[model samples]
Target: MEIRPMRSWIHHRRGEVLRQGGVGRSAMPGVYEDMLTRHGFEGRDAYLYRRHESTAWKRAEGAGIHLDLDGRLLEPTDLTDAGGNPLRLFYNPDGAVSVSRRSANMTYSARNADGDELYFVHKGTGTFYTEFGPIPYEPGDYVLLPKGVTYRIRPTGPDNYFMIIETTEELGFADIGPHGRRAPFDPGLLYVPSPELDDLGDGRNQDGEWPVRVKYQGGFTTAYYDFDPIDAIGWSGDLFPFKLNIRDFRPITSDRIHIMPSGHAVFATSTVVVGNYLPRPLESAPDAEPFPPIHRNMDYDEFLFTHAGTALGVPMPPASFALTPRGLHHGLPAKVEEELRKGIKPGTVADFEFIFVDWAHSLVATPEALAQKRAGDQLREGVAAQ
Candidate 1:
């Protein structure tokens, strides 16, 4: 809750501050002075830390992942129980990926890594057992596992599916200027069973061990260590798993023309922004454009994944994914706009269930994810076959 003053300056031909207004000549110097005067040494340190954190959050919030259309040879590992289907992994350049399947239960052990991981349950129900406690997750629930936090997953049903986004940097909430206080995807919105006690069942009756498996990369080879993955007993720290339901995300829109892209950000990390296109009324303008504008954004690489609706005029059958890299302009197809102009409510609650992952760093899609996109086409073909 520390507030910094604004410093305005007028620059001369030599790039020197000719005139200073408001507070000071530079924003940084004003901020530093404010920190030292208001907060003592300890407070100053906390202020600096918070400042850095805010910057990091902004960077991550503006970044995104663009879907890879080119098919490649990415790896898929099986971590499910006997006869259980395997969870597919789609790796991105920043060490982020998504896991999805019809009926698969997978477990990942806590380990030190160069990145942070996020789990979004698109469909299905399951429990995430962590050092803090067991958290029940379902479709639209987003969970984040900070780096080095130990945890595992236990499926409660047959069709347990998830979308995992792993990042090499810590993920956080986006900073919604001035009046914005709470995190875009506040942890409170994420439902953790009532009573906050382990009364669901025997905490030890789970099929797999408390600690499950660990995967790490070495020189020219990948190593897997198999042992009890849960060893975090009687330990406490700020790092832990937190879940937020996408449905609980409060969106900000406009009654006029257009809402800034930042308005669409639901959650963010160090280098990414998770945006939601919730169902809401568009700006009422008699001559308003029928579709959202295709504006060029430099801050993020946009990856739009269809969770339950058609996107950009494309009927994104379930599991369909698309990407638009930084500086790329994308919008609904022209024909879609024509349909909307004809007074058709083309947008629906189910049509806006897509998940957008924006990354600040350059991202390369894994072969497996590309294959999934290709498989989607095959699915369409199969539908045609019938």
Candidate 2:
């Protein structure tokens, strides 16, 4: 009888990285082809390609749509000044993506019975008045209002910016699995709004009535109340509005490999998954780089919002968004990869803070977003003028 410890050998052949390290060359033919075909890169000339330094996809024909905007410039004041309502960037039957700006307090509360509201405060200080209480929010807070929750925003100043993810399914923390009870942070640390009864002109107008608007079945219906919509004296529930600061998120990292996108997931619904990418230690492996691998996500449509990050010597300004549909090859630009190959010291902190969402089903881009896309010569001219 023979009992032996097996050693796994990682191997490379013909410019492809393979996992059967200890296998002899005579045993590689079938295994190599199977691996390539399974990954959808099969070809007689199939080889690894890097997208780490190339931004040419922004102009590529037939590429999945991507959007990058000066999110910081997309303030509510600017939208109102430009005579536009909150702008929708992408949408589908399941959900929608948009940005909203508010300069003053809202007079009426809003309740969306169709879906949950996930608000990322890109800029502004404000109080989110809800049935549970007055929840104070500021930049970087992720404020979640579950379906049917009445709420309104009141900014302390004249400017507020928010990115809204309206998911048809309710949003909640992703299952952390073996990571821990709170892989990111404990639920007790979540900022549950302290309930406060509002004093709205003695609880009512001369007519002794207040108003709350419910958005459902496609349109709004106004509901009259004897007191303000936020006049809940007290409440308790596992399902209530709360805020989680992105700064408080502790991203899972790896010492020797690039952490998979799933490792960064913070919020999830049956159809949508949102990841918070904060500054963290980069992959320390000798061959692995501090960027995403070139591949496709066949199961989900993916997007990234660059709240902050520096990549390949370029500072990815906050508020930029990018979308890549399933089966598309996307990753770091070529220039960024080139810089990484030259070597960045191990343990250097990655200067990136962003959010990524993967929609399990396809998402449709709005015509307005398509119309706004500039490429090729037009894109060049615009950059030159800038």
Point to the candidate with the largest TM-score: 2
Q: Whole-model lDDT, candidate 1? A: 0.48
Q: Identify the runs in model 1 with alpha carbons over 4 angstroms from their true place.
A: 1-76, 79-93, 102-112, 179-187, 190-212, 217-237, 310-315, 327-329, 344-351, 374-386
> Highest lDDT, which number?
2
- Model 1 vs. true fold: TM: 0.64
Tell me the TM-score of model 2: 0.78
Per-residue lDDT of model 2, residues 133-197, tens digit only? 88899988899999998887767887777888888877878764477876677776789887886
Q: Which run of 10 residues does model 2 get worst, by summed lDDT?
A: 34-43
| Every model's TM-score | 0.64, 0.78
Residue pairs in candidate 2 whose N, alpha carbon or C atoms collide under 3 angstroms = 9-21, 52-332, 52-333, 52-334, 53-333, 53-334, 53-335, 54-333, 54-334, 76-101
lDDT for each candidate structure = 0.48, 0.63
